[model samples]
Target: MPLVTTTEMFKKAYDGGYAVGAFNVNNMEIVQGITEAAGELNAPVILQVSKGARAYANHTYLVKMVEAAVIENPNIPIALHLDHGDSFEVCKSCIDGGFTSVMIDASSKPFEENIALTKKVVEYAHDHGVVVEAELGTLAGVEDEVVVEAGQESYTHPEEVEEFVSRTGCDSLAIAIGTSHGAYKFTPAQCTRNEDGVLVPPPLRFDVLEECIKRLPGFPIVLHGSSSVPQEFVKLVNTYGGAMPDAIGIPEEQLREAAKLAVCKINIDSDIRLAITASIRKHFAEHPDHFDPRQYLKPARQAVKDMVAHKIVNVLGCDGKA
Candidate 1:
């Protein structure tokens, strides 16, 4: 299948009561990992490129990688998306460059400014047959260039959601409930103590999530910062001589529950990143003489594939969703 807009996917997710995984991709391996997993499970996927990603890997490379995935996985639907485009210039560039969807993230601005900016992007995007996702609340996460400090995390205001969507004319809304960006999502102190003294993070504010759903009704909702910090991956990182203490992420059960509601798209990136890092660390620790990047990258790629497949089957509930 050629690249498609999220319109059909989101509608199906809303009607089916499941969420599609919108996995962020930066490089060839990352794109391959996500699409391979989605293909095996007969799942539709959204591959998104962040502004930082465009800076790291040139925009042309990112677009071609997504194009390659479409050719490689002809059976599953793939939506090439621009994640967290900060300005109209960025959003317009992606839309004209053939992205299937774009996110105009102006949530940090004042309400009126945000609406105006998002509306501008929506107008241009719709003209080009692309769907747009607008944000009403700020998510507390650090996905590359998007850095939200600790105290800045704010939930989406239920009161303003309708107005934001109506004014911006967005196809979906990205809201902040509790999930944060990156692997180190919570401090040990912020989480609850488990039986073994390991910290289990607090459950997401489902009440707030429900309120957003109520405001939007059946409209598609998106959850950013939704990675599940797999403990096994963390342990592997530590065991292989890497030191990342108490790296945590949103719990899978909560994500599963959200997928059953108005959440039609779930964004994930950290888990696959952790998998690649852990595999590389383990491989290096086990083989000190290995200098070939491919030797370690191969296992890392497999790790990414495994992680994404797990997210599709367990958290996002996108398996066989295509």
Candidate 2:
């Protein structure tokens, strides 16, 4: 009923071959949307908060909102998580502030430094009945509070995973295997449709993933910037007079395949944002006189709920696994 750690969720996902969706929450609407979807699907969910989000919504408000979701969804497991924590202080703060899990993402630092930082957080978190996730290879996405230039995008080195895990003792490891952050993951030049005119993003580097699995064995792996940008959401946004500039994400099939492997947590955020924006845009276009916040926000919340439900059914593969 209360917030739990990701340890059990990752273990079950590893054994069940379904990755739990870690959807970032910025406000009450997003939290309500993500938890309601997961609850309806009978799936365990992770409500993650990023540093930018904490600053935007305030940390106390986000924590209280997730607590409220727990009270509302007593049948399903809900984990409050800190996403992409960059410092010891950040991770420690979250661990102390009632987050069930916290990610100490020091992958951009030197290898030794990353291990040291992760170990520190893990040691502290374990003492407090919390779980810790650490990133090995830096992802090339522009998620809130985590911005890396495209030039910096690089796949996780398989050779280092074993050592990183052995030393850090993190409960889960987030890896980068060609899935970058943000909606504009690829350009039109990088993709072309088949005979059926279905979209096909560039293939994920499964070879690298294979190598990581070979090194870590059954260790839980995570995928960040994992939002599968729904074409329907994009259509809604564009039709309502918003330009997204050909945003794309990793295909759902690839994510499904990864779920069957070591992946237990798939981070998603951009899709939720896109869904809210689309609904709000349409409401404004249709109701020019609408001024009350709830007039448009209510529809936006419903749209997010629908989007998350679709994701639980179509992506992440967490349905019926609560």
TM-score of each: 0.98, 0.96
Task: At residue 96, give the lDDT of candidate 1.
Answer: 92
Query: Pick by TM-score: which candidate is best?
Result: 1
Per-candidate clashes come to 2, 1
lDDT of 1 by residue, 174-243 (tens): 9888888999887777898879988798788888889988888889999999998899999999998889
Stretch of 10 with least lDDT, candidate 2? 193-202
The positional error of residue 315 in candidate 1, measured at the CA in angstroms, is 0.7
In candidate 2, list every pair of residues with a backbone clash.
141-181
Q: Deviation in angstroms for 110 in model 2?
A: 1.0
- Per-residue lDDT, model 2, residue 281, is 89
Error of 2 at 268 (Å): 0.6
- Note each model's CA RMSD in angstroms: 1.0, 1.5
List lDDT for all candidates, in order. Answer: 0.91, 0.89
